[model samples]
Target: MSDALLDIRGLTAGYGDVPVLTDIALTVGAGEIVALVGSNGAGKTTLLRAVSRIIKASGSLRFLGEDVLPLTPEALFARGLVQVPEGRQLFGRMTVAENLMMGAYRRRDRAGIDASLAQTFDLFPVLAERRAQTAGSLSGGEQQMCAIGRALMAAPKLLMIDEMSLGLAPIVVDRLLDVLVAIRGQGVPILMVEQDVFAALAVADRGYVLEHGRIVKAATAETLKSDPALQKAYLGSDS
Candidate 1:
């Protein structure tokens, strides 16, 4: 079996005629956590959407060695390429449990789905505690957890999370990233897009720096942490 879970080559995508991603190429190996970091308007979200096939794109997108560019979002989900999108797009009117159950809507294995729900609760006890509460009633951090748990219900092989640390307290973000690390330990590769560069790099095994829709640097987390250019551009200072 190949170690590369997801691969992209010469990816070019955008909205309408305006291109956002230009000649982008990257890879996520099985069980690896790869972070995509960049400043605002750097096309980080567009890249994830392109990989998820949510928008029209031109590229070689492969998952598990099979071409994925031809697949739709639903098809991609069926193949375990699940994305926890930015803004935690949960059903506001639905109960937390209901929203979570929706994640397994495509699944037919009742017993297996139940098992996965239990696992999700175990991973996030807060959700279990708030199962009866409407999703919109939860705190910002709690909503984020529900979003991730919902994606997990799909039993994805490659989990793509966008902006995991957005709009949360530092402590909350830390807790969420810890759970993500735990999830990675279960052998699921993660392609994470985060503006919280320090936190993202802390957990990432390798990372790519995207600027103006291009990958300007690819390096291990340790090397990226020390790059002066990255430090000045992303980390706020060259020192």
Candidate 2:
């Protein structure tokens, strides 16, 4: 836990008087992929927003050994903390290249941004081919790719993706997961919120099962894979 890249301690966050997350504690170490899995409205997205400082939160959030709760969203992003939000929120009217350019808005190093763009294109070749096309015209999978590419344009150390597989076909999800594995291979730590428990756990090093804004289970991916009780609770039993 001391070596964690992102650490949250007793994090309680919500909107005004309406509380959504209760005493949520989680951590992602260097170069590790951790999945936060739960049902809808279980506060997974709210937790991510809290970590990114998009929502008011109470508790300690430390990133790379520095206190992160005080930082603004842009400041947090500048410090290599980026989140690919739940919906692939792309500029529908802008071309693919332009959308990616938006990711580096706070950056002054044009040369570095271009180099990162090339790296992103290399990671997702489809985006390169469709650079001139409007983001709205691309398929859902392509849109997700562009969204992730836009995040990479910032050259983040910690990339948090929320529901990357949402509304996509199974085949597309599989392909996207493959790209995520490659991204992890590049040594970037990822904290993901996924609804597809089975698929998420298959690719995760470890997973946390969240319920009603609280983490009810935490286990290694292999252990969770064989957990009959967890299967019945989260994954659901065939019976």
Candidate 3:
């Protein structure tokens, strides 16, 4: 349990009169990269939303052995739980540096925040070069990099990302995956909800397969990637 950074059991959430997620259970251990993969409307994004307190939910949601179901989104951010949402939701009018600054809105530590900013630049050198450019003017992949860098400015313990590979070239997605690995090496666990099953499983330590708002499978990355049933259903091949 000490190893677990995010422990979710029987997590049920949805919009009014419509259930989007039900009975979801998963664990993200400290410094581990976990993937949640499934088809459209499988509730992958909803799961991350619930954890980040963007929506109402039920059941036990724990972070670092403490019940976090009652925490507000602001409180969650203070606890080092941050989400880099889908679609790279950057402020189109803001410069890259201003966008990153927005992520540290909850912090008052000047030195620490500056250090985090420097770390972000180190991780994504292109961001450093384009710090003054408006986010809306950047290419798709550069926007994605800025989004992740902004999240890191929060100094998150668990970074949840949704559809990270969406609308990006394959090469860009691959580069982001490598960056995620480096972030994990620096001790930030990640919960990635990706549509690209093969790519997600390749970098994840473990993965949960969500279908129809339920978790249908949980296993090590190798097992999930090699499972004949999973391969046939999601990867478009049985091999």
**Of 2 and 3, which scores higher on lDDT?**
3
Q: Write the per-residue lDDT of candidate 2 for residues 1-239, one digit (tens) a residue.
A: 37799999899999998999998889998878899998989999999999999999998899999998999988899999999846999999999999999988888998999898998999899999999999999999999999999988888899999999999999989988887788888888899999988888888899988899999888898888788877886767953
Candidate 3 Cα outliers beyond 4 Å, as residue runs: none
| lDDT by residue (tens digit), candidate 1, 1-239 | 34588988899999989999999989999778999999999999999999989888997888999998999988999999999857999999999999999989999999989998998999899999999999999999999999999999988899999999998999999999898899999878899999999899889999999999999889998998888888887767848
lDDT of 3 by residue, 1-239 (tens): 55588999999999877889998889999879999999998988888889988899999999988999999988888898889956899999999999999998888999999999999999999999999999999999999999999999988988999999999999999999999999999999999998999999989999999999999999999999889998898868857
Per-residue lDDT of 17 in model 3? 71
User: lDDT of each prediction vs. the true structure?
Assistant: 0.91, 0.90, 0.92
The whole-model C-alpha lDDT of candidate 1 against the native structure comes to 0.91
Candidate 2 ranges with C-alpha deviation above 4 Å: none
TM-score of 2: 0.95
